[model samples]
Target: MWKILKYSFADLVRSRWSYVYLAFYLILGFSLLFLNNDLSKTVITLMNIVVVLTPMIGTIFGIMYFYSAREFTELLLAQPIKRRNIFLGQYLGIALSLSLSLVLGLGIPFLIYGIAQSSEIWDFGFLLLVGTFLTFIFTALSVNISLRNENKVKGFGYAILLWLVLAVIYDGIFLISLVLFDDYPLDRFTLAATMFNPIDLSRILVLLKLDISALLGYTGALFQNFFQGSGVFISLGMLVLWTVVPVKLLLRKAIRKDF
Candidate 1:
């Protein structure tokens, strides 16, 4: 497994796309800091981009990696190695490569700007953490989609559709539902809804950490107050669940799947 993992990691790290991903982050980080010297404000702006963009990139990368490597993967399948190791290693390789791009891309700018001396270090770190979580979660989902669909086009469609629903459509539906039933109490409903969508849960979690109560409004305040001291921990737990379940499903499917 480690050997397979190492190979995949090395292979991806060497890809031109990997360098492009890294360069993109480097530019984004420098640009954001150049435009705004405020670290916290920069982090807030980044959170919006990270939450949506990371997942989409992860989804695209996951689908692309799995399909591109299909021939090699099939070759590996004929060997005595376990299917779980092969797929999981590939999945981890893609997720970690993307996470590395995000960290280095954003981390370098902040580090140079003196985030360590600033009060927003933890907030910045949490933002990166959330981005990493989103990457892993979406990568796992995309890999699962790829595993299920033998056709590359179909896999890409399903993966993008998954991202769209969670990132955009889900929020629209949630807001509409809230407006339609505004008269009734929605605290529980809101909380429950937030939990179901990793993106919403992550946004609320970061906003709560930033202590941006004004932006959080009613729902954010409720989450902050409801979770109280344990808000970050609870949200982290949910993100873990989001990442693990898809991974588990991926492993299971790989194990029983006919290559």
Candidate 2:
């Protein structure tokens, strides 16, 4: 597993797309800071981008990696290795590389701007953490999609559809549902709905931590009321579950799968 992980990470690091991702973030970080010297404001702008972009990119990368690595995966199946380990290692490698790209890409500019001396360090750290979590969650989801679909085009299509539903469509439905049933209490329903979608959960979690949930209006207030206390821990646990469940399911599938 470790060897596979090491090679996978190395291979990805050497890829052109990896460098492009890193460069893109580097430019984004520098540009955001240049446009706005306020770290807090920059973090907010980044939050919007991170919440949507990371998951989409992770989905795309996961699907592409799984399909591209098929030949390699087949070669590994002939070796004395557990199928789950192969997939898990590849999955982890991709997630870590992308997470690293995000952290360093955004972190470097912040550090140069003396973010360490500022009060927004923790907020910035939390942003990176959520980004990492999204990367893992979405990548695992994409891998699952890829594993189930042998056709590359169909796999890519499914992956994009998954991202779209989670990142965009889910929020639309949640809002419409809230509007349609505005008279009734929706605290529990809203909370459950947020938990079901990683993107929503992440946005709420970060905004709650930044103490800006109030800006979101009613739903924000509800999130603030709930997440301000021990609910934060619960939110974190859900994020962990979001990452773990898909990974576990994919691993199980990988084991019984015909390679």
Candidate 3:
């Protein structure tokens, strides 16, 4: 597993896209910090982008890597190595590479700006943590999609569709549902629904941590009140489950897949 992981990680790290990914984050981080000059606000803005962008990147990269390495993967399958190790190593490699891009991209600017001296340190840390989780979760999902669909085009299509539903359409549907049923109490319903989507959970978690859930209006306040206590733990727990389940499914599929 480690060997496969090391190879995949090194392969991606040496790729031009990896440099571009890292540079983009670095540029964005510095730009945001330069323009905003406020750690809390910057962290909030970053939270919005990280939650959406990481998953998309993860999905695209995972599927792309899987398909691109198909020949190599088959060669490995012909060897005596465990299928679980091969797939998991590749998955982790893609996820970690992306996560590294995210961290270094954002971390450099923040650290330069002296986030260590700021009160938003934990908030910023949590934001990166959530981004990493999203990367891992989505990468695993995309790999699963690739494994299930032998056609590269179909795999890419399904991966993007999955991201769209979770990132954009899911929020749209959630809001529409809330409006349609506004006559009744929706606190618990809203909470339950948010838990269903990792994106929503991430947004809420960061907002709550940054002490700015008020911008979410009544809904935000409701989230603040409910999650203000032990609720953060519950949300984090859900994110953990989100990250773990997809990888489990990926491994299960990989082990049983016919090469």
Whose lDDT is greatest here? 3
lDDT of each: 0.90, 0.91, 0.92
The residue ranges of model 3 lying beyond 4 angstroms of the native Cα positions read 214-222
Clashes (backbone N, CA, C under 3 Å), per candidate, total 0, 0, 0
Model 3 lDDT, residue 130, Cα: 95
Question: Rank order by lDDT, top first?
Answer: 3, 2, 1
* Error of model 3, residue 65, in angstroms: 0.2
Worst 10 residues of 3 by lDDT: 211-220
Off by over 4 Å in 2: 216-222
Candidate 2 C-alpha lDDT tens digits along 173-254: 9999999999998888999999999999999888876756666556656666678777788988999999999999999999
Task: Indicate the TM-score of model 3.
Answer: 0.96
List the pairs of residues colliding in candidate 1: none
Q: Model 3 over residues 1-259: C-alpha lDDT tens digits?
A: 9999999999999999999999999999999999999889999889889999999999999999999999999999999999989998999999999999999999999999999999999999999999999999899899999999998888899999999999999999999999999999998899999999999889888887776666655664676777877788888899999989999999999898778
lDDT of 1 by residue, 123-188 (tens): 889889999999999999999999999988899999999999999999999999999999998888
Q: For each candidate, what TM-score against the reference?
A: 0.96, 0.97, 0.96
